[model samples]
Target: MGWYGQVKTNRQLQVRCNYLNGTVNKYLRPIGGITIVADIEQMKISEYIDRAVIPLPKAEGTDYRASTITPPFGPRFNAAPPKPRGQTGFKLDGNVVSWANWKFHLAFDARVGPVISLASIYDAKKKSYRQVMYRSYISELFVLYQDPTEGWYRTMLFDSGEFGLGNFAVSLEPLNDCPSGAVFVDGYYAASDGKPVQVQDAMCIFERHSGDVMWRHSDVEREIRETRPDISIVVRMVSTVANYDYILDWEFKPSGSIKFLIGLTGVLQVKAVPYTNTDQIKEEVYGTLVAGNTIGISHDHFLTYHLDLDIDGDANSFMKTRLITKRVKDKNIPRKSYWNVEHEIAKTESDAKIQIGLNPPELLVVNPNKETKLGNNVGYRLVPGSAARPLLTIDDFPQIRAAFTNNNVWVTPYNKSEKWAGGRFVDRSRGDDTLAVWTEKNRRIENKDIVMWYTVGFHHVTCQEDFPVMPTLSVGFELKPTNFFEYSPVLKTVPPQHLSWANCTK
Candidate 1:
């Protein structure tokens, strides 16, 4: 047995032998499973160590054959017919995409992979294109493994900075990673020798329908029924960083909502363990032993985003609209309590540092000069998806390297030098040039051109199902129009209907 958890004891099993040029040493045993002697001279283990004594987990009668497992016998389970071919509803003009009055220019960066810029939506009443987001892209990815050994302590990987995400992007497989009717786009990145290299089919764009209804209502009294189907245009890219593959999708809905999602699916980084059964273990293991000799360690993934929202124009303000509970002060009123909305504008950079709370506030970027038909400020709401906060404290080594994850959200005055959240070159950075450092000046941000940074975090705990290859785990965020549009953007639209087998037979 080998060292399992964080223990101070030096109980290790290393069988050193003079085989194959005398450099063979294998620590194949766990200390918790077997007993060891205090003094090495007292035990005669040196005699057996003359030859290589390390053995495989399967050779020791432990069953770790994941590929040989068979499924249970059952009847045929085909329950539905083949889906009909889907038609495209969006138009592509070079890199600019247009669908349902939504237009955006898609560009690729060597580090960030996909960049969306010049995003605008058409207004039905005004019949003009209104600006929403000027530019947006993934700022950085902080990945750290939780092993403190000599070989595993410094295993920190920055997917974007260390190795260019666009450079390592592989051609997506049709009908597998993306749909059959996707439009593939090429990308380019600079080589180490300062020459530009082309990446073929680095991104795919397509329209998706998930059989979901956007809105529907039925009024039996008035004999009126209405329904609207949900449809979206998606831009996807998958970047394989070492052993992990990250799939990023940007979904644009007709209702003026942009959803940014990231999915992780790949092999787990496993370490060698010795124990085969739980009863044989006396001490605690830091990670779960999925196989007989393999232990998958815990880890965390934090993806920070750079968003420059031009709600109506370049000049905008950040505000937190909170729902506060109020007590009825008038004794004549029968109601005891009520709720009211409170908006607080962020005047300085420090005022915009937000930690997600149980009672979260709505983060909005509004143009102070513009107003909607209802006299409300034109704005877009920053809606967070299923995410977790970075659990590491600020002083930790890993946290120091990625200080941008200190807050879930941060707003700063727009600067061209402040693109990457971690730094420009994050291979072995010392945390000097980070987003947290720039926000320390506490510059004025009220009604000024600003950038909003948000981090989507994940805390992973390995299980048996994550052995050979892990299933995809997803996290995302959304930018939805609150009062930027006068009313429902998809109110006056007609969608196509699908004919079922029963309906076609009749």
Candidate 2:
């Protein structure tokens, strides 16, 4: 019902009648119909005021709950480190010496069994010296790829008993006793006795779905010839690393698209940026507004591409295809400011033209001079989202520094500290952790230049089951925090919500 009509005829009828009589000089004094005219302005004003003053029910806070969020996905259960399965031991007989943390007690037939090399290093903490070694297996076979997605590539490591790099050992042993002109098949290494060694483990074949063994390499070639009419294979050895290992990187360019993939295993740590007293610029520049021991963070932005193919012939005559994309750009600030493009198109065998162009993006300032400092020589500390006001003294600087230097913070070898991955202090004579080497030839660590390096992997404690192929793994890097916000510096300002709502009501 209409508000005015409902008010006059219903529960408020008495109030409305009193209001009308007061404005009309009591109905008794009303003149004849033609001469009487009522004033209605005061009654309308009273009704408006009553409606405006009515109270609204408050919103319920308890029901406005948020759902629990989960962390990024990782392995369901951690696998224990692997144990050696072969009958091999260290022999300290010649210039080719080897070592291991554990004692070597086994022997193997020289012709068919794998040779082991051990190198020793004194461990002050353990109050003893230990030996480290490397054991490898070699083979040739066909590997298959099931999923060819951009970031996720699934391939089977076939033709070996265990076809992946595991936590083995590594050492530089001399190869003096190897046959002068004989060609080594695959898993070949030198022993501490200066003699050549070969791995004897049989090749392993894998089932596509369950990751189980379907056939051994000894039986696969025969079975495939009898069943499938056409097949292709490549010659490569399946090997493992010892205590320390580096990632095997490859740049794939298919149809003018480039994609870089890094396979990981072994011990790895995250990289950190360091801000020291020396990084401060003496001149007052737009972005060089250093406050105290603090300096600004910087970043490099660039683009890369990826490709996929659909082939239908032998390795030589197969058709090729690809996709282009910008994998990631330098992110100095919270929000990302870049674009991505992808496509899929095929090309005839003769028409294939693939190239890679690794171009650097235009350099731009991220954050202007902001207050920053090295927190206890562990990590870079900064007041992000705004410029830190000028600090008057050293005490004031440390106060701001203490707030960000708690646990879970770390320093890495990225900038001047890049001389060592664990940071420059580990093996340097200066005893200063921040000491870095400046050289033009070293791409990973340069002096005073800002760069990002991130290390990723699992911390493994040794166990029996991981003796073979370790699981596939990966980690990532991020542009460190900087003031190079893409838009205006005041973008963080909050607007007046209540004032805007009131204006809308008026």
Candidate 3:
């Protein structure tokens, strides 16, 4: 009996080891059900560590070069006018005439990916205080294509840090650095007491592949129309949050693809944390790492969802529901109609549901007392278990579902409001919010519903020196295959190739 107990305990210990390392077996029988819970608690500490290191497939060859893509515009500073209106007397007759030109400096470091490098930092001793500087990484690649014949431009899909894949677009006009369609969509009036004055410029990056435009207009139009339209677009701007100071622009392609690009002109600072693995470190040890060195925690990840009601004759609009731990059978609270309630009540209920599970310490609510900031016009909180939880686990499904069902609000062309990111009215200076009005008109004409869903994720392990000016990091969202696409759009495209020194030598 003694020997048998020893063997059983050994087996349990082994199981615990696997669980802590994220190699838990789905079908393994526990020695006893009660003991498993204890093991899980003990294992949770290391589980946090596992979440910090996202295991991407190793690059097949050393010679594989990262894409040489810069933001279509110059850096954010360049995008700003040389002088503010107070200094430049361009505002003749009390009406600003020629606005200062804005440009974006979107550059990516070839040495390393944003996520990897931003998680590492360095310190320099300046005159008085020890100054820290962070390196920048490639958050995402934004590719804009204009099918000259079609008379419309669309953005291509690319990877945005930890966020999943989707079509993302940024509306840039000849006049301003603000997202083209969004400035007016979100309704930031310069006349407002605290809003910045409107500035316009006409400088943007335009790149064209030899045959990409021709191929798109000729052979890709039908394919593009048939493609899924649930693309994602996000806008990142300087905000009150500590250490998060970059504006992200996101969009969904008409092809149902997702695209995201980074607009960096924000404050960067070093944040100190208790430990590399906080939970694992004991009471006496002071575990600390710079904020930039932390691997999985993203400044923010925003998701923009556009569902078309015209499809399937609008017989039944597809709705994704949050996974409720305790299932409720009230059909009146149909998942599809959950957003019909009063906006405030809806938001409260949504917050309640997200708070139920394992919540993160850093996640907080948008202040009700404070005046509205960029995307905070609508309320949002970071859902807990973002980093520690599994991507498609039962614990997380409901939160995802709730985001779609509860956070949704019907937007009309006339409604000029903005959330944390993308919406109909993007540009504030435009006389009429084109995208907002267009979307509203389209919704009525086509009898379609426009809704958006967002999710945030994180990873926690970080290093030192990610203080002062920290390096850049990347985060994003994805639009999965949900019968949304008419055909397998990616089927015709070839898989990505692996380049190596050996291939070149051959």
Candidate 3, residue 90: lDDT:
20
Model 1: per-residue lDDT, tens digit, 1-506?
22223334232333321112211112212222222223244544422212222233332322224454356644556534433333466778888999887899999888999999999988888899999999998888888777765435655667777776776787887667877567788888888899998878889888877779988889999999999888888999999886678999988888899999999987666555556676666765557776676566788888899999998899999999998999999999999999899999999999999988788899999999899878999999999875577776677766776889889999999999999998886755667789999999999999999999999888878887875567798889999999888888888878676666665766
Quick one: ranking by TM-score, best first? Answer: 1, 3, 2
| Order of candidate numbers by lDDT, starting with the best | 1, 3, 2
lDDT, residue 472, candidate 1: 91
Q: TM-score of every model?
A: 0.83, 0.18, 0.29
Candidate 2 local lDDT, 1-506, one digit each (tens): 00111223221111111112222212111111111112243332223112222121111211111232245644566432222322122223332322222222122322212222231233333356432211211111112222222111211222111122211222211121111211122244455587875553211111111122322233565664211111111111123332123232221111111112223333211101122244444543212112222222111101111111111110111111222434345566555544543322112211222221232121111111221242211111111111121122323322121111111111111232232212222111121221112221233211112322112112223221221222444322211112112222222223213234433657
Give every collision pair in model 1.
1-29, 1-30, 2-29, 2-30
TM-score of 2: 0.18
Kindly give the number of clashing pairs for every candidate: 4, 22, 76
Model 3 lDDT per residue over 1-506, tens place: 00111213211121211111221221111111111112333553221112122222111211111253334744446342232222321222221112111111222211111111111111111112110111112222211121111111111112231121111112233334442222211112233265543212211222111122211222465654322112222222322122233344332222232233433322222122233455644543212333212221222232232222122122122222243234445877755422221122123222222222432222222223222223321112222223222222322322222222122222221122422122222111121222222333333211222222223333323334333233555554333223333343333332224346443666
Give me the runs in candidate 1 sitting further than 4 Å from their true place.
1-87, 332-335, 497-506
